[model samples]
Target: MTRSPATPLPPPKARRRLRETAALTQTQLATRVGVTPGIVRAWESGRTTPRGRKREAYARLLKTLAEEEAARQAKQKQQEQQEQQEQQEHQKPDEKQESAPAPVPKLEPESKPEPQSDAKPAPEPEPEPRPESAPVALTPAQAFDALYAFSAPALVRQTFLLTGRREQARESVERAFQAAWERWPEVARDRDPVGWVRATAYEYALSPWQRFRPRHRHPEPPPADPGDRTLLNTLLRLPPRHRRTLVLYDGVGLDLPETAAETEASTPATANRLLHAREAVAGRLPALADPQVLHRRLTELASNERLRAAEPPAVRRGGERRARLRTRAAIAFTVALIGTTALTARTAPTHYEPPVSPGQAVRGVPHRVAPGALSDEELELRQKLRDQMQDGPERLLPRLE
Candidate 1:
């Protein structure tokens, strides 16, 4: 009997992408392939490969998923093209109407010319200026700079409202922009780039570890105005999450859903936080019970503080510097690790050597003892031998035949 050849599979990354695109879980894929989820995970992570029947099943499944994803993308593209065509079709009449000239007023033959006014006619009004053309597309760096310029100052102010510390706020904004610069492509393509930076800044400003920072351990000076000071103090008193929600919703004028989304909280949770924050503020100052009034006060409080962000170019340079430093540090660490591993491999013993056992006392062997006194019989025999030896010399004459 002959066996059929195994199907070819995509790369690990593509395999994972195919599964995600199909909305299939690792466990589900594992079950279909008759393997454990762990094995499937290992396969997707490029740690292991499947073989025999499982390999063929996984390959076939991925191929189908890829086809489906491609088809979906094609359909979406076609729909977008159709929509664009429809929009152009709708715009044609408006363009024609705008381009057409007005009919000239017809003059009757019986009409008589009215007498000219003696006074100078009113000066003709200047025609309104035409709208400017659409702007040219910006390069990535230019776009990043524009976004930073437009949002940084306002974001610093908003972050100040959240943290009530001008320096911390500035630092947070700088860090967020640095991160955005590091991921400029992603941020630029995001639907709301401002929101992305805002969220990052908020997260940095509200991080619990900030308290451990030596610079942040001390409190910053309050705003100059008593009202501003009081408002700032009240805002600082709220929990970080609530404070963030309040600032996003009231200070920045974001809508409830947007605030919730930015804060990563449910709408109801965000509303509750906002309500609690407002109640706390109003309790401290009776005048801020109204949302509009609270918003105005928050804005006024933030604006009253003097906070500045680093220049965009400086921020971008800083981000790049940080990235290079991190990369270098990682390389150093990896080199050290590899060196240590190689050293160990070179110096390690090749064969096992059994350990030597410790010495133990023998069971039956008698220990040596010092001789004390010779017995009397042994002493007498020694004396007799001394006397007999002297006589044995006379008796030692040669014996004749």
Candidate 2:
């Protein structure tokens, strides 16, 4: 049996509470419902009211989360009760001993009680040993905050270098962090969570579909730094692979193998790309012709104040993710069609027999006609006709009888 979907109530507080209970970051919730995090944040803050399917989906997801949270809370309460009961069971013997009456001292005829001093006191209870406490789990907020604090700035800078667009750089970093916020528990446990964020930001910044996007208008700065501008322009103009490879190797200081893993290419392929990239840059800029000079210049550019991020912007990316998918599918279909046509043409038999010329009809002497003997029936008919011509018609009629 199918369960009815939950209808989201119109109250903003109600939705916010549902999201809190579900432990979904606004970004995660937005992603689940196909909206921007800013939109989700607005909805939660009562700044906007989603309508139509958005409203319906918002309600349904919240209701489902509320149900799940209720179930989880109920389960936790049951577990706590069971744990208390077990503790009580373990303490039963001691509790029973403590509750029992102290053994009575029997008095004998010759027995004499010792003389009581000025101080007479009843027996006191011995203190019980303390039990060890369980370790506490870190709250989601603390985990997420810590990760964002340590990683976001670096991700923004790295992405800015990769994309050369300040707004796009910020978008990429935020998107990466949003993903991290959603899976914080696992991220917190990771060996290099920062590395994961960095790689994600790189991929986001280097998204192929970003090419067709309209450029962001930047307010003119006081004056451009010649070296930084030149370097950025050079990096931006190189093919994406070469540019990204150089940044990862020279900018981020990732080793060849690390660069390969992050870029999703083989070590040898990364090596080749980096090598060619260095040559490409050298060809363009005489100052970067030497390897040592190139590294120093790259490091200086990475350290520039212009490369640092100011604050995370409230924008969204990944419109390009779907567009890229469509482009790849279209390109693949076209390639397949071309390949099939080429293969067919290569292997198929040719049908081009040159047309015979009009005057060539007399060619080959028109293959001489050969005479042949007539059939026996024709011969007999001829002989009968000849006899008919010699003899009278009455003689031929009598023979028929």
Candidate 3:
């Protein structure tokens, strides 16, 4: 498989937010992330993304953000609870003191009640409150480890494929983490933060760049041996909605219904796009080869490690930043390819058959065939013809019998 040229993952704005929140200058964050202050500004402003090992550094920074946010929330909650408990305790003593002297008067035993057949029994007493445990905060290191472990390279790869640019995917992923970190206290409670991040990243990946930024060009078909390059190219030529349907249905192993949900498209629309995409692929494939076979082969190739080998860097450098950049670039490349392929398939001609044949008689009009289904004119013509023939044909035949 021919590796496409890699692009650098661009920097994101989270750094600026972090700095502002921390009341620190760009120099401060740069010092922490081990980059020049200028680099910090560039990243914050979307000028460029950090490369290779720098991603780990960035991840670490995000972890710090999560930890700090978590700590702040935990402290606030603890303070609130403590204050409420203290207020209650202070009020309890006063109430008890006032009531202490008002003991119940001694009284004679009451007469026993007669047995009742229909009375319902009362419910049992409520359980006592269990001792509450101390709030445990996730350390920055622990949070970083979790994020690192849960971070799937595949998502980045997919994003890269969609955008045909590396930095964009990295920024998207970083933004996802930044969002999560900003609300870490709430997000951490979720059973699947990784899943949430993945979903968010994909959403970001799907979104187009703002009008100011360069619009993405459709991805070119990858070389064959990786599959039918022409078919892939055709698939890439489709509209985004249709292309997504095709990818989710074929590339991502999603059924029609699932693909519909994933793409947020109606079932009929999804089905139509998928059908068209398949037809386009079929049209482009070798006559002897089945479209299904080609689709499966392409899917396999996409998933293959050999095909997925990280492309060589346009400018090689030794370090963590470079590595992160490479990973992001690879991811972006993959996503662009998948999204483009799906889009392409949707727009291409599908060889759809006509629903109606020319000269077919229609009800209510003359027998002239319409471009679409029988036009009103044809319908009327047909009705007139039917009425004319209603009387026995012998009525119009010559009397010479």
Which has the greatest lDDT?
1
lDDT-based ranking, best first? 1, 2, 3
How well does candidate 3 match the true structure in TM-score terms? 0.34
TM-score of 1: 0.60
Most TM-score-accurate candidate: 1
RMSD of each: 15.2, 20.2, 32.4
TM-score of each: 0.60, 0.42, 0.34
Where does candidate 1 stray beyond 4 Å? 1-134, 357-401
Give the Cα error of residue 181 in candidate 2, in Å.
Answer: 1.4
Angstrom error at residue 127, model 1: 16
Give Cα distance to truth, residue 6, candidate 2, Å.
Answer: 31
lDDT by residue for model 3 over 227-300, one digit each (tens)? 44444456557766666666656665667644554454445778898778777766666541464675566555
Model 3 misplaced stretches (Cα beyond 4 Å): 1-151, 185-195, 210-232, 255-257, 286-295, 298-401
**Global local distance difference test of model 1:** 0.83
Give the deviation of candidate 3 from the true structure as CA RMSD: 32.4
Q: Which scores higher on lDDT, 1 or 2?
A: 1
Measured with C-alpha atoms, the lDDT of residue 209 in candidate 2 is 78
